[model samples]
Target: MNKILLGGLAALALVAGIAPAAAQTVEFTVINNSSYDLHYFYTTPSNEDHWGDDLLGDSGVLEAGYQATATIGDGSDQCLYDFKFVMDNGAELIEPEIDICQLSSYTIND
Candidate 1:
């Protein structure tokens, strides 16, 4: 009886120690309405240790009035990330700020 109880307690402890593997997939649609060709960069917000290196680096030359779609990851975060778009001439086009959108709020559960 003692061995059985200990085994059950160990099993419970093992189960409790394991965290649930929550993942998220994000799809991004980028539109370039500016006259100049735009270059974009993506990075995880949590990546404070390495800024550009941690970025997904979805760089591209987007012509004016052109649109592109980018799909990224199975992340463990609660929401999706709104990738930061930077132009080749060192200008940012996103309004308000860089980390603006709340993509995680509308994330789809898998």
Candidate 2:
């Protein structure tokens, strides 16, 4: 992840009013350990059916063995969120109730 993404996360956290010492310190690290390069990253409310904007925006690329980290919400207090990782080949992995608060990192295994 680049400094631009980190700066964006900081802004998001502040807008959401997440305390500095809380879960906001921990980032959601998306790992692409598969053979394919993941192109899009989405995180939305667990109950929502539609995937929200790409979390990666213009910096959306998690190559094999690499990880991209982003802080999505306020300490939020809510633990559930959906994650979608998509590849160029039209393959995708969607995970629900990711418990973003408790997870230090999330991995998409081979």
lDDT of each: 0.41, 0.69
In candidate 1, position 73 carries an lDDT of 45
Off by over 4 Å in 2: 1-26, 74-77
| lDDT of candidate 1 over 1-110, digit per residue (tens) | 22432343344344434534554444455455666555554444443322322122333355556554434442434342334556656776432222323332211111
TM-score of 1: 0.48
Off by over 4 Å in 1: 1-21, 46-59, 80-82, 93-110
Best candidate per TM-score, number? 2
Clashes of each: 2, 0
- Give per-model TM-scores: 0.48, 0.72
